[model samples]
Target chain A: MEAETFTLILDLMGTFAFALNGGLTAVRAARVDLVGVITLGMITAMGGGILRDMMLNVQPATFQDWRYLAVAAAGAFIAFAFSWVLHRMAIPIEILDAIGLSVFAVAGAIKAMNFGFGPVQSMILGTVTAVGGGTIRDVLILRVPSVLSEGLYAIPAFVGAALTVAALELELNGVAAAILGASVCWLIRVVGVYFKLNAPRPPRVEPGNLQG
Target chain B: MEAETFTLILDLMGTFAFALNGGLTAVRAARVDLVGVITLGMITAMGGGILRDMMLNVQPATFQDWRYLAVAAAGAFIAFAFSWVLHRMAIPIEILDAIGLSVFAVAGAIKAMNFGFGPVQSMILGTVTAVGGGTIRDVLILRVPSVLSEGLYAIPAFVGAALTVAALELELNGVAAAILGASVCWLIRVVGVYFKLNAPRPPRVEPGNLQG
Candidate 1:
């Protein structure tokens, strides 16, 4: 397959996975109706890309392309319709979430590179693209974003973005490199999830010990 | 002053107000360090404009201009240094927040008009620019956004934006018109805060009454 085609496929898959994950989270977290479920799902699926495009000073691909919207809505609807069954399969849902994270990280980095951003900026944008939607969803539901608090989520995305940037720098801008970067990210995230690992926290301070 | 200069002044004032508000909220709500406080403050100050610029397919003015960064940082620093004093001045802080909301709403609509967007789209963008930063701040601190759940926040912004658009459409785009729109929004918001007013909610449903 052409590189563009491959990337598009990955993007769509990520969109579907993120939408499903977001929808499931909304159903579990809030006393929301159908509108809320689908809205959250679409936001989760499209937010990162929109954020990235904004930084790039470009139109959001999500708004420009119909497929993204359709796929995201479909995934959210499926999650809403089968929340009872999906809620019980937490592990599978997590795996799908990891896939979305990895794909977005890789795709975001590549797009940044195409847009002529520096390696560091590209890597950061990639991670933002990967985690932005979930953060928004968590905020809507009044929870601290897992990316900021306790999770190996951002680290894996960062690593994936970094690897993708490095590959591009080394003139390895092939589909193979993209797959390798995403797969590595997926592996780290899955392992972290299985082991229930977390990034280090600040040393414990007594409540109200530090005034603003 | 030229309309351009006036808009810039309003934008800066709004940025400062939002930064202070965000920093104060962080100090009161979370046990975060200096970095956290400043980060949240900057995000709250700039998120709305960045979101608006993204929709308009333009570079964010916050990143382009050094003044915005300096003003926002200064406001956040002030809040951090004077948290104890500022915390006691609740009404003042709320008034400043309303000022920020009003300024952002009017300026955002005017910019959209300058960019040749339709009145409806401009109105929506203006409201988004007013509320986007606060919404992002609420999410970061893990609270339900006041815009979605309670408060007459979005309504006042929408009204201000509508008025701004109407003025522009009527070829009355002057400093007076801008002030009129923003003042109305600020007045409405301040009154709402004083009265503890809220938008109407959906009818109560039994717990778990509606499936996703």
Candidate 2:
């Protein structure tokens, strides 16, 4: 594969993993076969990028290209078909999630720059794009988004993407810059998960529990 | 009260009713408690508007004014407190829904215009803002959004908002023009519900009930 194509494959893999993550969450939520699973997968995979593009007055990059949809659909279909067996694999999914977070965050920042937004806005949008899909998934499933409630979920993506952009502005190659940023995001997520490094939860008063 | 404040009260009623509808949905889905309920209410009331404003490069109108948050919060509290009685009421949720649709669609369009978006984009954003919260809610919960799947849910808002903007541009007083547009939207919704109007459904194969 050409260099762009090689990078694109990693990007698609990340999308696939995110989509599968969304599908798994939907299954747990018992909203079986509602278009929610498919939508969730799509959102988790494409949501952040879509939000960034739309906000910057650009048509969604996914719409301009087709591979993103194919990857999301393929991932959800695979998960739906073999969920019984795949549910048992924990380590693979973990790795997939980390990769997805890093790639999506980097992609978000790059897209933002292409649309001419300032660096601060680009970083924020990139972080949002990276986690927005998962956040939407959790909220719809009536769970607090892990990004909002969990530790350091979106922050590392911001840091890495911002640093990568700064390096590129200092004349780094685009591919090298993206890989560098993606690595930074991935390392942070892996450490946060394995080491229990996460954000502090807000104090919440429990309401009187109603028996469902 | 000043005319604007009077209209604002009416606007608050619309927000209250809209948030109540969202809270009730969460309840019916068997999810409860204050945090989730409040979040749901806020999402339903402001999701669409936030998306619209962000796209238009303006801060969301709701976050700018505290009244919007207060109305949605109070609405959620009321819904939580009296859900049983409200659920048992003879009238359908559609009645509250119609009132909400009218107020939100009008308010969203007006806000967009105030931010100086062009006629086309303002109408588009207004329609999205009115339904955007619910869309995000459905996507998160993994259900097919009513706007995308249920047919005609958002079109009325689009039409009404477009008309409202056009009339305003034609030198109609803002209040009179908005009222006219809202009534048109309200009537469309009422008629659609009464007549069971529906949009096109996506093509799909049913699971395993096929005749051999």
What fnat does each of the candidate structures reach?
0.28, 0.03
lDDT of 1: 0.86
Candidate 2 residue-wise lDDT, A1-212, digit = tens = 78888878888888899988777666555444534456566667777777777777765566445677778877766656666567788678977888988988888888888878887888888888888888866766667677877677888888878877786778899889888998998998888888879776676755655433
Largest TM-score belongs to which candidate?
1
**A1-212 per-residue lDDT for model 1 (tens digits):** 87788778878989999999999999999998999999999999998988888798888889999999999999999988999998899998899889999999998998988887778768878988998898888878777766765657888998999998898899984677688889999999999999998764323334688774
RMSD of 2: 9.4
Clashing pairs in 1: none
lDDT, candidate 2, equals 0.76
Tell me which residue pairs clash in candidate 2.
Answer: A36-B142, A48-A129, A140-B140, A140-B141, A151-A198, A151-A199, B48-B129, B48-B133, B151-B199
C-alpha RMSD in Å of predicted model 1 compared with the true structure? 7.5
Report, for every candidate in turn, its global Cα lDDT versus the true structure.
0.86, 0.76
Model 2: CA > 4 A from native: A1-50, A53-212, B1-3, B54-60, B63-66, B90-93, B137-143, B169-171, B204-212
Model 2: chain A TM-score against the true structure: 0.89
Candidate 1 lDDT, tens digit per residue, B1-212? 87788778878888999999988887777755555566578789988988899888887767666688889989887877778778778998888889899999988998898899999999999999999988888879877787999989999999999998898789894677778889999999999999999998788986787764
